[model samples]
Target: MSGDDILELENFLPYRLNRLADAVSRRFAKTYRDLNGLTRPEWRTFATLGQYGSMTASGIGAHSTMHKTKVSRAVAALERRKWLTRTPDPVDRRIEHLRLTKAGIAAYREMVPLARGFETDLLGHLDEQTRRAIVQGLAALEQAADVD
Candidate 1:
């Protein structure tokens, strides 16, 4: 293959985006992990239920972009910790609705301010113009990617 056929990973958009996403996730993970020993999927599952009240495992997976296995594991972990309750549907025993328990709500409330602070601090590094540009660029990228 000639030089023209070679793909430079360093200059690739998808690679750069993936690296940025991983770094950001890790940074935020430290906040919740330190407080609750939660993994990324666990945190995502908890936060999704906290924000949206109750939902089925498949619903959580779709809403959070997590795979079914990840959602199942997170839900199981949270249930074991007594942070969430799983109630079987009245008509469909196979379907279970997951909701944050009082303890989980308390934990979520505690994290809300910290989560906001983290976002604030992260954005504080950028000037207003750059921040607006970044937000616009990301919105455009999401649209282009057909992200719902």
Candidate 2:
């Protein structure tokens, strides 16, 4: 098949989504690592906490679709870095709830603009209507998948 006759991967959803997610993740990981020394899992943990404050480690794992062990390890690493704090749940003394430290909050705040700029650059070429449609479609997919 001639190159001109070939349909490129841009038309395939799974391949395109995986590639896009990996590329974006790698870029974001590098940026965050330089700024805060965060690994991918650690960054995931921080992002989860930044969105949902004070959750049990298990809750984080569930919400992030990560294994409990990975979540626990990331929590420990973040705690050691003073980026997060763990405290016993008042009602469930056996469960430790996680919260972002001041430093963690500040780091998240600093990363937001950079992250937004990166996302904006990625989507900037698309017209507003296409962008909105894409977002709505993705949201619907996530909802259908019960990604809560």
Candidate 3:
């Protein structure tokens, strides 16, 4: 194959998406990290619990697209901070359900506004039509990828 047939790394859709995701994640992480001293995984775990009420670590991992080990460490960190509690599943001896504590809930609530602000700031750079186009394009890409 000629060099003309080779993919350009900078222009590749997957590479661009990954780079954008990383940049956005890091930008948002500053809010939670500065205010709550939470790592990305810990903040994700906490947010998942806050949104879903109660779930197993495996569930959190699936929802967050995080590995099992990352989820475990995040759970442990949140537990240490008294931001989460674990309860044994009634029907499953080995399964433990996790939920956010009152403190965790408070933190999540506080962070929501900050997150919204960050999103607003980022999207503000685009015009209304551009923003809508970007959203529609992302939806189409997700559909094409069979993402849930």
Clashing pairs for predicted structure model 1, backbone only:
none
**Best candidate according to lDDT:** 1
TM-score of each: 0.95, 0.84, 0.95
- Reference-based lDDT, each prediction: 0.96, 0.88, 0.93
Clashing pairs in 3: none
Q: Give the range of the ten consecutive residues with the poorest summed lDDT in model 2.
A: 6-15
Clash counts for all predictions: 0, 0, 0
Tens-digit per-residue lDDT, 9-107, candidate 3? 999989999999999999899888999899999989998998899999999999999999999999999999998999999999799999999998988
Candidate 1 vs candidate 2: the lDDT winner is 1
lDDT of 2 by residue, 1-148 (tens): 8988987888777789889889988987888899888888888899889888788888888887889888888999999989899899889899998999999899888888888888898789899999999899999988987877
Per-residue C-alpha lDDT of model 1 across residues 84-138, encoded as one tens digit per residue: 9999999999999999999999999999999999999999999999999999999
- Best-to-worst order by lDDT is 1, 3, 2
Which regions of candidate 3 deviate over 4 angstroms?
none
CA displacement after TM-score superposition, residue 69 of candidate 1 (Å): 1.2
